[model samples]
Target: MKVKAYITLKEGVLDPQGKAVEHALLSLGFQGVSGVRVGKYITFDIQVRSEAQARDQVEKMCQKLLANTTIESYQFEIIQS
Candidate 1:
């Protein structure tokens, strides 16, 4: 199975990188864009026979290593491959 994980900062957290991108876009004449938040996308393969097992492993991976859990939140999708 393949897993795709998205990790992002929680609400009310300041994202300097996102802010920088927003500012650069505004300066380049990109309009109507606001509240830009930057995040991480990870894709990898997991050896699992069932979706339930894959989900359980991925959740643990995120909690233990992939995400901060305090200032960051994560979501993942399992894709058969």
Candidate 2:
């Protein structure tokens, strides 16, 4: 199975990189940008017998290593391979 994770900062958290990207977009004459937030996308293959197992494994991976639950949140999707 293939799993993908999207990690993002929780609300009310300051994102310097997002701000910089927003600024750059505006400087490039691409207006209409009110707010910008940056995040991470991770994809990998896992050898699991079932979707349930894949989900469980990925959830643990997120909680333990992929994300910081205090300041960041993560969501994942699994694709059968």
TM-score of each: 0.96, 0.97
Candidate number with greatest TM-score: 2
Best-matching candidate per lDDT: 1
Give the least accurate 10-residue stretch of model 2, judged by summed lDDT.
31-40
lDDT by residue (tens digit), candidate 1, 1-81: 989999999999999999999999999999998999999999999998899999999999999999999999999999988
Please give the CA lDDT of all the candidate structures: 0.97, 0.95
CA lDDT, candidate 1, residue 68: 99
Worst 10 residues of 1 by lDDT: 42-51
Count of residue pairs whose backbone atoms collide, per candidate: 0, 0
Tens digits of lDDT, candidate 2, 10-75: 999999999999999999999899679999999999998999999999999999999999999899
